[model samples]
Target chain A: MIDPLSIFLLLLSASTPILFAALGELIVERAGVLNLGVEGMMITGALAGFAVAYVSGSPFLGFAAAATGGAAVSLLFAVLTQFLLANQVASGLALTLFGLGLAALFGKPFEGVKAPPMIPGPFRINWIVWLGLVMVPLIWWFLNRSRGGLILRGVGENHDAAHALGYNVRLVRIGAIAFGGAMAGIGGAFISIATVLQWTEGMTAGAGWIALAIVVFSNWTATGVLVGAWLFGGVTVLQLRLQAAGVKVPVQLLSMAPYLATIIVLVLISARQKFSRRAGGAAPGSLGQNFHALR
Target chain B: MIQLVPRSEVSTLWQFLTPVLAVLATMVAGGLLFWVMGYDPVAAIKTIFWDPLFGMASSYSRPQLLVKAAPLILIASGLAIGFRAGIWNIGAEGQYIIGAICGAAVALAAYPSEGMWIFPAMVVAGAAGGWAWGMIPATLRNWFGASEILVSLMLVYVAQRVAAWMAFGPMKNPEGFGFPGSRNLQQYPSASNPELIAGTGTHWGVVAAAVAVLATWFLMSRHIRGFHIRTAGLAPRAARFAGVKPETLVAFCLGLSGALAGMAGLFEVAGPAGQITDKIGVGYGFTAIIVAFLGRLHPVGILLAGLLLALTYIGGELAQLMLNLPAATVQVFQGMMLFFLLGFDLLTRFKIQRRVVA
Candidate 1:
């Protein structure tokens, strides 16, 4: 049987990639523009980070490359939805398809190749896990305490009002979108560099969508994102542990727990979103609505 | 020196030309991508577009077009309806898996029993599975304003694992030597959906795809419900004011899409695939999204668009076998189609003009 402490640590590590992506998307949603391309971005980051790490023999360089790759794809989204007034949802979806395709094509050459050795970490916990723990509080501070954070919340609450106040909604949004993409990239890199430790086609395998749900499961708060990631991580991590323990429950049924948890969490959050008009925890006012200023 | 004049009517020619131009643009951009990948761009493009009908390998790959297109058209046609209504059902993949699971479950339960009712019962169960899976988001969204897109999508992973479990567990063929998968449905005569036209690759699913197109066309063009769907999508406030109950519309759109998607899964399991396993839902749910978008969400467009996308699948395989190109290039090509389509679609809503400084 696996040690409980190691299993707990393993779950924390597994949760990091999803945590990074969810937190990033949370910030983006907070700014009123929904980017559904996090899956594409994550995959792109996975490939980019993996490739750079392989070539340069530096995991840090890989992370940087992943961020660049994610941001680059996000730039297309920013231009369309922010500048061209395209529908945020559609543009984001298109970006995902495009990114997935690009990654697949790019990844073909790297198929069967192994990633470099992982960057060593403190106490059997890697750098990403430590950073992910730090990022949760850091993101909390950035969103709630900082001036830029206030502006971001303002835009999400009311883009037109934010614009009327000369907050440069487009510029702030572009920055937020890029930041979100970079974070998603880091989350993706965690998979390639730290977890799976190899470049496989479609390796991220629905992690991006899980991250997206984490934002909702977290109730759109940075702290909630960490808890949701860890919560999901615990469920997923538990499944693997159950499989190892040779539990009689079919691994298939065991696997259902994590997704079931996600659905349950979503149900709870949705129930709140439904009833909360009376209780008042609303999605940011301008979420999923594109802003077109004719100034 | 250009004279400043009032903008006249937008030409009808632009509308017809835009979608075509986007397709052509995807091809050109796709060729550039091929070039970057160090493959012969022209040859790659030829395989994707020209090979299905006129290329040297046409005779061999021609039939697979129908085989591949059948499921895509079936799924995309359903997805297009919800997409048109702005319901955002992204979990068709999950629906597909659950439908297969339900259908396969019915078959597994009736193993070694030869009955006429068994197959039909499986079909009904398949649809129920899909409908139930789709209702997760539909009910959630209708009751509580959750994003259906995320909920629907998250379920795909869950469905996949469930599929893996079933294939490796109780659903496994009892008599067979402990292999993960159950008895191949292909070997079972009563449950199998065989090719009606033999080499033409025409199966029950293809007929279903045809039926879907006709039904969708009739529904969208001649039905009052369809008008409500369009109105709700284009102008939600106007739709609500027009007395089109928003919740009902959401439920109907999701339910309809789910049923059609479910039927597609049933047909696929009984036909070309011939079995339900972890590999059953092979990106069709997601790929169908591209088909829906590529076809501009029109049933007729989907018919032609489905074949076109199917051509890429066939050609992608050919490219892989003949030219050593990766299988993923076709997806890249598909992605380019959306990029070009959205970029071209910009013309429908806006036009650019230059302002000269005095």
Candidate 2:
């Protein structure tokens, strides 16, 4: 018989990476800029964090390094797409490709190295898991009640109007994007520093994209992100369990559970949102468009 | 009051010239990158751009160029069609894998038998495999409004693992002492995708790619469906009013793109690749996306773009061999292409204006 508590622990561990990335992306979209470079940033973080943790033998510091690395790269994206008014999608794709190449280059020497031990959690759970749980409510309260939060929502709602009201639209978006990058970095670090406890090529395994989808599935809400992460975590853990049980299904087929589940849930939520629009709110206006300030 | 000057419209000449211009610009950018990497930039560029076609080793490398370009062109042509309509199918790599597996399975079913029907059956199976893989996302999008991009891209990893499992397990050559691959298709002449004329870099894939270019050109320029795709991309609402069903277009684009990608994989397995192995997928799917965009999502343009990209692959390899450049230099070039393409494409969509707030 499968242990429910073990499953819960596995779910918590799996959800940490998604939680960190989705939360960051949520804050970004809330600021009216759609940056699709989360995948790039996360991978970059994975390499940087892994390198740090591997060399220094401290996973915590590795995570800190990852967040800083991810944020720094994200700032480059911010400068090009935000300040230079470059197309968001293209810039994001460039970032992903650039990040992948750069990671491959920097991580050539560090390939196949064992990662340092993870910072232990309460009762067998890691601290990142606890941090993920804490971040959900933290993000919720900040989005709803904080002073800077209102300014971000204002920009997302209408950049022109927000600027008309003398709010620093560019500054707010850049900060949000940078924060999103840091969060994604932390998410990437979780993979190397916590879950795998090892570094490998293309190690993020599309987790960043999954996190992006989760943000949409959650309808840009915090608690929804937590729920979405758990759901994905469950699917992933269930697949691994099925494999261990020597099920008749092909391991390849079983491995598809997470991706298939993501597609299904994403479609389900999209359908719900589409149908619920009569009562449901719309996606923020001015989303994904570059804003130009004529000075 | 602040004065704003309207930017001039880019002419038709610039429209066609931009891709060529982008290539030159990429060379300059790539050169600078090479210079930073400590290699003589000029030598690296020549070894990459010129050596594969006209260098002393051109005889060997030149044939390889067509061999590589054939599948990329064939697959990218299909993707370019959908991309033009704003339908994104990023799962070509998955489709390619499925196609190779299914096609090779067909050939294996006729194992050691001199069956003339084997090659034809494999071709159909390959196309079917790709079409089926593509329909997963297309059907979901049609039924439940899913994001095809995510579904399609996710399927790639799934397909990859499936390929790995097959190579190591059920599909493993029992006679070959625990090897993680299947019987070589090249050994079965009846099942093989033979070159039309040997030593000319000709294959079924090259023929298919050329045919695809012509077909797509006709479809996009003359067909009503083409009009719908273009209209839908330009204005989805207007296209809807014009009686184009968004769901139907999504399925058609995804399905067709998938079929072509599958065909490319099949041809590779039956011809150049010669087996169903773990290395069946070699980043062609992702690279094809770049080809679709670089070609500006036009069929004829994709043909040129495919060859150009194929050149880089061969050239990058040449550079690596001759100049000790990194293998990822090609990817860096591709990144620069998209970076420049996106930046330049802005001219087609929006006119720039300068103003000062008083």
Candidate 3:
């Protein structure tokens, strides 16, 4: 008795958080930085957004705070890697750990608090959900057609060359990181403020990691990211529907399908890149490497 | 304007000094956080760092340090090796869970038997299970060119679900009136990992951690293979020239670390935890990454870092009991410590210079 339109809408809403996050990370990667703290940014956003929404009774304000909070936290990572010249991978991991702990510490009081109801957009979908949908084309345009995106790609492909061309590599990367953080924050807030409408500890529950996997699966394309998000969203919806329909499989085992699917897709994509000669890898050249303007 | 000039030679003194500096910085930063949270920052810091070893309940908390530190040290020891080799096996939590499940399966199968062989069999099974789980990512990376970091991390989620399934389904204890957990290994005298010395918390895991530290120290300092690992990490092209096979090193590092993590899990299930439950993967796998880095990826350093982190855990608990602080206080401290350590490590690698604005 599940209607197709309703299911489609459900999938859109379900995929919104990951969509925002992957899009943000896509930009960051294009700028030659790998911030593995997506999960951290997200959780921080979830708590901050929820707390704001509860206190102010405004979901929009909640989302704004989430974005600011996420960017603020990401600045910590920017300072560490961009200024201190710490290892990008380790700093990113540290950022995640730090963000998670900071969120939990402050989030204790917000436990059991309900978020204000989110106002729906034109067709009854939440406004944030619509924003996520619109961002796909917006990001695709920015990455492929914009002059600024070309410069970002140049920086990612070769920082030294970009620096020679008189671009501020560090500033570009920090901007990208901040944007990624804001997007991840909005995505995280969507979970607590829109979907669940309640704050809980560790409620993001690996969505941040799932978003990371989606980015990889997308082959760094905005459209590919859309497809990847939908695929994951489809799996999540289908699994929950099966559980509701009294499927014979154990609930715990069934819940594992999304994660397992992520692994399998990772293997397939990686294998394709390995086996195919024509597939020029789209991974940004300076991805995950720290930039230093050495004279 | 400022600039950083790479030091011709790494500063050995700064290497030794940064960790101490990092800890002090974290204490200061953490104190600010506590102050912002409206808590008595000084007292909270004292409860976490000072009161654990010398306070009124020091006798009880002191023994608990070994118990808490054992798994961290054991897991970090193996992880540090892989890290040094630049092989990130971040899925130790998954390995830990699978190891416990396999080890418990062996014990669960031989229920009601008095044979001593069961305990040893569990250990072997645990290591094998972890090794097998770890090999999945290794194989994928070798064959398909996948990022091990992503693959290993993804496996952690899958492992958590599997653990939940085991707890509610096959591993549920029949005698416990439908409780979603297995037979208590503590009550099963032959299977339990009891303290070796009374009131000292000297369990087999603690002994294994000590052994791991020593073994790794010897390997990193004395073995040729260790040289190969370091070379591979620093200069992969040079490592290849030196006859070091990248595939082999990847497999070895991941496998060995996975096995060690599994053993840690086995010891915990048979000792501290007492049964298999859905909540078994308690962020130890992730925390050990910090321990590895904080220890400067050195075995002896990991030992000290492990104890320090475990102290935070015990202290965090004491703070909760005594000061009504949230349980997450310890986690926040841990995160802050890592942040400070990474930030401070810059002093050892480069010379900060004032750019002469011409």
Using Cα atoms with residue i matched to residue i, what is each candidate's TM-score against the true structure?
0.94, 0.92, 0.99
True contacts kept of each: 0.64, 0.46, 0.72
Candidate models: Cα lDDT each: 0.84, 0.84, 0.90
Using TM-score as the yardstick, the better of models 1 and 3 is 3
Pairs of residues at least 3 apart in sequence or in different chains that clash in candidate 1: none
Ranking by lDDT: 3, 2, 1
- Candidate numbers sorted by TM-score from highest down: 3, 1, 2
What is the CAPRI rating of model 2's predicted complex? medium
DockQ for all models, in order? 0.58, 0.51, 0.79
lDDT of 3 by residue, A1-295 (tens): 8899999998988888899988999999889898889999999999899999999999999999999999999999999999998888888888888888888888988887778887699999889988998999999999899999999899998999999999999999999999999999999999999999898888887788888878888989999899998998899899989999999999998898888888888889988877887442578889988888887
- Where's the lowest-lDDT run of ten residues in candidate 2 chain B? B1-10
How well does candidate 3 score on lDDT at residue A112? 79
- TM-score, candidate 3, is 0.99
Q: Provide the clashing-pair count of each candidate structure.
A: 0, 2, 0
User: What are the runs in model 2 whose C-alpha is more than 4 Å off?
Assistant: A1-6, A83-87, A121-124, A279-282, A292-295, B1-11, B350-358
**Model 1 / residue B163 / CA error / Å:** 1.8
Model 3: chain A TM-score against the true structure: 0.98
lDDT of 1 by residue, B56-96 (tens): 87877888899889888988888888888788998898888
Q: Mind giving the per-residue lDDT tens digits that candidate 2 earns over B147-259?
A: 78778878888888878887877778778787789888887898888878877688888998899989989989999999998899878999999899998899899999899
Which candidate should be chosen as best, given DockQ against the real structure?
3
